[model samples]
Target chain A: MAVVCFMVTMGLYFAATISFLAYLLRRSEALSKVSLGITAAGFVAHTVALVARMVGSSAAAPPSVHEALSFFSWMLILVFLAVEFRHRIHVLGSFIVPLALVSLISAAALPDTVPTLQPMFRTLWLHVTLSMLGTVGFAVAFVAGVMYLIQDRLLKSKRFNVLYSKLPALDFLDDLNQQSIILGFPLLTLGIITGAISAEFAKGAYVSWNPEQTWALVTWLFYFVVLLGRLTVGWRAKRAAYLTVIGFAGVILTLIGVVLKSYGTVS
Target chain B: MHVIVVGLSHKTAPVEIREKLAVPGSRMGEALTRLTSYSGVKEGVLLSTCNRVEVYSVVDDIEQGYGRIQEFLADTHLSLSSEQLTPHLYWHADDRAITHLFRVAASLDSMIVGESQILGQLKDAFESALSHKTTGLIMNKVVKKAISVAKRVRTETKIAEMAVSVSYAAVELAKKIFSDLGQRTVLLVGAGEMAKLAAQHLIAQGVGQVRITTRTPQHAVDLAEKFGGTAVPFEQYKDDMASADIVLVSTGASHYLISADDVQRAVTVRMNRPMFLIDISVPRNIDPAVRHVDNAFLFDIDDLKQRVEKNRAERLQEADKAEQLVVEEVGVLREWMKSLEVTPTIVALKQRADEIKRSELDKTLGRLAHLPAQDRELIEGLAASIVNKMIHGTMVTLKSEVNSSNGAAFVESARRFFSLEAAPPQDTRGESAVDSSSCLAHDMNAPLVEQVPSRTASRKQP
Candidate 1:
């Protein structure tokens, strides 16, 4: 049931991608709605697959790497649907669906190992979930930033093609980028605080500031400066978009580094 | 009844010739009446707009109808002789005439295809023709079907969705740049006519605020009042740039008015929020270098014109789909028209048969004058029954062949064989015989049951 659900979710995302691409090529409003419907269906199937995985588990263990990746992709889709609803930027699906598809496919390829929960962070599932949400938010911001730059380049070059017509306005994309940052920063801050508290309550546990941890701090501070600069120095548009991309890159690199660093302990 | 269309549009005539032939608004009733007064014309409609002048009519004979309408065209515009005007006027007969009328009503033949103005113009023309009492059964059906077909074209195709005018194109582009224009400020830097038109379009789109600034302060005040906006001093316009989302510059300046450095300053002040700068002046009021400024997009009149051209091309592509839809609808209408061919033949044959029966019965009664009145009545009844039976077989044959491709030829052959040419066709002109509602009811009661309309049967009012 779980495998079938995963395949169906993947198929829907692929269909949504084609629909969105067709809209971009034709600048069709009807195709945009079709793409939105397909993506929403894929989101539902993805949510069902996640629930099935949880129900299939024994409940006493922590999520494995593959499960965490699956949950992260689900978070991304959930955030995308919310942004799509609020902004009505159906064309953004053409850019974001491939990312969701790749992450889900990667998760599906990984072995479904049921590992015992770590003693120190067994009760810290809330922190992990919050951090996933934060990263998902940042990923959304990354997509918006990329879209802004493309639109900005097209406008500057004065090449009004189908892609240029399909993209949202520069101002709207910039605003969406700001919104994602606003939603992600506080969630990341709370997740970090909760993780620290959980580590402190565990006996003989010391929260070490490893290189990956330090990198995560730098990513948080980078977004902090971006938000602060937007408020004080009025940094926006191209500069803001570039800074958002850098911040998201920081988050991804830190995540990969931490996962690899802890690979030896997973067994 | 035969349908005929005679007209010249933008395609066939230049503006000078079109203007000469255009019937004035006050003279429309006169024109329609004069058209129907012509020989062989039973019902007529005159459609005269700035783009085209056309006459639609139901007539007794197609050849004589075309000749009369062409003479009327020559007479309406005395400046042009019949010899010169013949090349400009086009005539369509029968089903082709109805198809032409539908295309015009649907705006396919318009200078700008898919425009909504032509539909209203057609309705106005129809209203004038109806009030003049020159439209009869055939024209009534033609007008209603044209209107419904126009509505269908609008709903089924994307031809009418894109903007073809420059001002409308500017508004569409602004909407693309800012998802909601209701919160964006528009700064008009000049009070030119084009600028006023663009401002009106923006206002129609429900923009937040419009500020006008011009060298002529009074003109600025007047334009502001016209659009219900605020007037700002020309010098202070630069100060309002930071607050404005769109800047329209169309001053008749010989040199560039707004420079790149000025736009850069505005961008800095507005926190790099995206700005659209439109320069619609001949000499170009805003410097083209302003496009290089971060978050500042500048478009001149040429760019907007190019956008309009591209949009027009897109609409043209959509018109291909609209034309296909029209072809399908015309085919349906043609089938309905073809079925009416059998009606006239049926009426003629029955009239001829009854006349023969009456003449022979009268002769027989005269020769047997000594016979009683009851014997004469029985002889007359027997004659009528034989006529009815003979016509019934012919009516059944005609009805069965109505759907065949050669059904019309068969009807004509039958009419010739029965010597029905001497009999006149039923004349229901200048009456509310085929009013659309009753026509639909008649269609519901037809032999084909939902396919062909019973036009001839229901086309007799009271």
Candidate 2:
């Protein structure tokens, strides 16, 4: 039953991703609405499956890397759906749904060997949740940044085609990107701070110079520069969009590094 | 039917000619009634604007309607011969008339291409005819399609982007230069009609100051006071031009009023600041050579018209997409019209077949009065099956014929051949049951339950 539920959730997630991509390519509003509907259903199913697995294991926390990864992916999808519902930005799903599907598929393929919860694992869970929330924010910002660049280019070239016609205004896209960054950057800072505190709480002594921690700090600094540049230099729309794309790239690298380090240490 | 459009426009005739033929709004209804009642005319719609007064109509005889409409116009107001009116009057047959209406509604045929006001005017004329019931089926379809086409063009094209008139062009140029024109100053020279119009545009753009000048100081003061600007003498016009960022010159002189030297001095006095000068006069008031001076941007009438032409071209490109949508919608409406023609014939044919079954059953019942109830029921079911088999081929043929071009005539023929003119009593029970079920479905959270399973069961059992 657990495996069936997991497979169903993953299938719905992948189907939603494909539909969202179709909506972007074809620009069919009907397809976008359907994609959002599918994503909502998949989110509900995924939540049920996660709870079922936790209950089946009878564990206070996630027992394995697969479970932890699944939890993180589920959290990302939930955050994405919540934002989509609140903001009503159907285009963001074109980027986010695919990422969620990839995460789910990867989590499903990983070995499910349960790892004993060391005292530090609880601290690790907190770190994972915060970083995941921060990454979701970055993902949304990246979508807005891409739209802003495309819209700005079209407007500059004076070629107002249907694709450009369908997009939000240049000013709106720019503001959306800035607002996402503003909300995300502080959450990211708090996430990194809480992560350090967790590390200190678990190890009795601070662990320093880890590549994941170093890269995370670097990602934070990149966004901090972006926020500062926006505040001080009166950064133009295109420039801010480019910075967002660069900052998000740093974020992805940090996430990969963190995942790889955890896998290496666990094995 | 022959369609003739007569009257004058800004192209062939002046406003004085058009205004003489223009029917006032109060007299429009009486005009339409008179036009429809005229000899050889079947339907009529009159379009009267400041530029043109054209009567569009379908007539029984082409030359006769032409002569009647010409005589009617001659008798009403304009005492002109057919020879005089014939040159300006354009006569169109079937397809030309349709295309003319389409172009007029789309604003392509207007004096100003893509001007949206003409479309609204056309719609008002159409609705007036509709209210008076003067339009026939052909005009109804044509007017509705034209309105839809106009709407599609407006949405799909950028044709209505910038102002086309020279006065509006001057305003638009200022807007492009300064996104917010609330602080700009405008200087008007000569206080001519063109200059006054330019001042209106400047004030609309939120100009901070409007300064006017003329050879006659009283005229300049009167115009300045009207538009909330200060008046200055013609001798100080160059000085006022230095203070103004936008200057409109429309003087009545045959020679250049503002020489290149005058603008050159103003450019220096203004510290090489950019100035927009619009000269909307035939005997150009600003020197043609002044355009070469640094920071002095000059636009004559021809230059402004050229920009308007470019904007019109861009709008035409967008109209192509909109035209495709209109064509698609028209095709859909045509299909619905065809289907509507087939419906009544099919219903009547079914009723005829059912009536024959009921009469035969009544005759059989009289003969089988002595038979048992079970045997009588068996015989009745067998008779109904035979009747169904007999009409099945004809029903299939009717359904196939509906998809053809002559489908309406074919259905009419079928109804006559089958003696099925009278409609059968409608069964309200089944319809009421369906309506109630739909209401129940609406009240509930789920969709209307699919009847496929029950339908399949009935098919298999039968």
DockQ values, each candidate: 0.47, 0.01
Evaluated at residue B9, the lDDT of candidate 1 is 86
Structural similarity to truth (TM-score) of each candidate:
0.57, 0.42
DockQ score, prediction 1: 0.47
Residues B71-96, candidate 1, lDDT per residue (tens digit)? Answer: 99999989999998888889999778
Model 1: runs farther than 4 Å from truth?
A: A28-30, A114-119, A202-207, B1-164, B311-462
TM-score of chain A of each: 0.90, 0.85
Q: Write the per-residue lDDT of candidate 2 for residues B1-462, one digit (tens) a residue.
A: 344455455567654455456665556788888877776676677776544567777665677877777766655565565566666656554445555666666666655555565665665566567666667644555566666666666656665443235567677656533434666778887644445656787797688888887666676776778888898877877877888878888654545778888898887776554567888654467998886675566787666665555456565565565555555554544443333355666776677888998899999899889999999899889888887887777677777865443343466556667876532212121111110100001111222121111111121100
Model 1 CA lDDT for position B14 = 67
Query: Judged by DockQ cut-offs, is candidate 2 incorrect, acceptable, medium or high?
Result: incorrect
What is the lDDT of every predicted structure here?
0.75, 0.65
CA error at residue A45 for candidate 1, angstroms: 2.2
**Candidate 1 residue B145 C-alpha distance from true site, Å:** 37
Off by over 4 Å in 2: A56-72, A112-121, A204-207, B1-112, B115-462
Residue lDDT tens for model 1, A75-133: 87777787788877777888788778867776766665633125466556766777777
